[model samples]
Target: MKTTKRLDLAIQKLYTAFHNNTLNPECCKQCAVGNILDHTDAWKHLSDNHGSTTLNYIGMVNQKFGKTFNGYSPLELLHIEAQFLKACGYQLPLHHNNKKPKNPTDKEVLFLGLSAVVQFLCKLDNMPDVMDCNQLFQFQPQIKTSKALMLS
Candidate 1:
């Protein structure tokens, strides 16, 4: 089980990486999925070792888009915002007057959420300390029970 302190630190690092534009947009998605996968000892080794997971995640994403991951340069994190919005069942409003600002894409919204989560995690120490691993596991059986659940 991951400690809140550790999770908080990871979130802070993630946010810093994003804000500094140091994160590869494609890699960010892979990392997010990989972090969830890391909850299981079976897959934990994949974290910090980008070879297999990066290939796999990119392959999956490419398959979804009917494109090849190979030879495709990673996009800017902001550019993929539309993809996230579509995944979340949002439709960008049509510009009738051609003067309204465009709605944020799904990918942008997702990046924002990821950034916010990281920021929120960084602030956790200031919040009331509540649950230890044992208590959290007890309350959230899904986290403790299986890798699949954690990834899902």
Candidate 2:
């Protein structure tokens, strides 16, 4: 399936960050949205607190002016970060004392975070989730059920 140019770029950057061990849920400049915006922490100014979906004054102004950073609105960026953090086993808002993965750089942990961000990105673009494997399972049951029904 064809993806938007922005989405494709975001995915590429995320893939690079993941492989480079730079994807960190607790770091603004290395999180999902940050990586998508080319490793910039400027997106953090869009929200009053990290991991928050609510946009602050600056974010509201940007939203009012129809501004998008790397093709993502301020609100969308915030949501993406929240999704990544949650999938990475971080407590929302990213407190130092919050529960987090034992190995923050673990491939499994990063994969989960990336999966969530990709899923959310797809949703924003009104596309089917690339990370979804339900279709693989869906066909299996249909074939088995049809054969079982025929035998019955």
Q: Compared with the true structure, what per-residue lDDT tens digits does model 1 show for residues 68-149?
A: 1122222212122223223323333212332221433235644754554443433433442232354655654344557766
Question: Cα lDDT for residue 112, model 2?
Answer: 93
* lDDT score for candidate 2 against the true structure: 0.88
| Cα lDDT tens digits for candidate 2, 36-102 | 9998999999988898899999999998999999998888899999999899898878778888889
TM-score for each prediction?
0.27, 0.86
Local distance difference test, candidate 1: 0.36
Residue 97, candidate 1: alpha-carbon lDDT: 35
Give candidate 2 regions above 4 Å deviation. 134-152
For model 1, the superposed segments whose C-alpha errors exceed 4 Å read 1-3, 28-30, 33-107, 115-152
The positional error of residue 30 in candidate 2, measured at the CA in angstroms, is 1.0
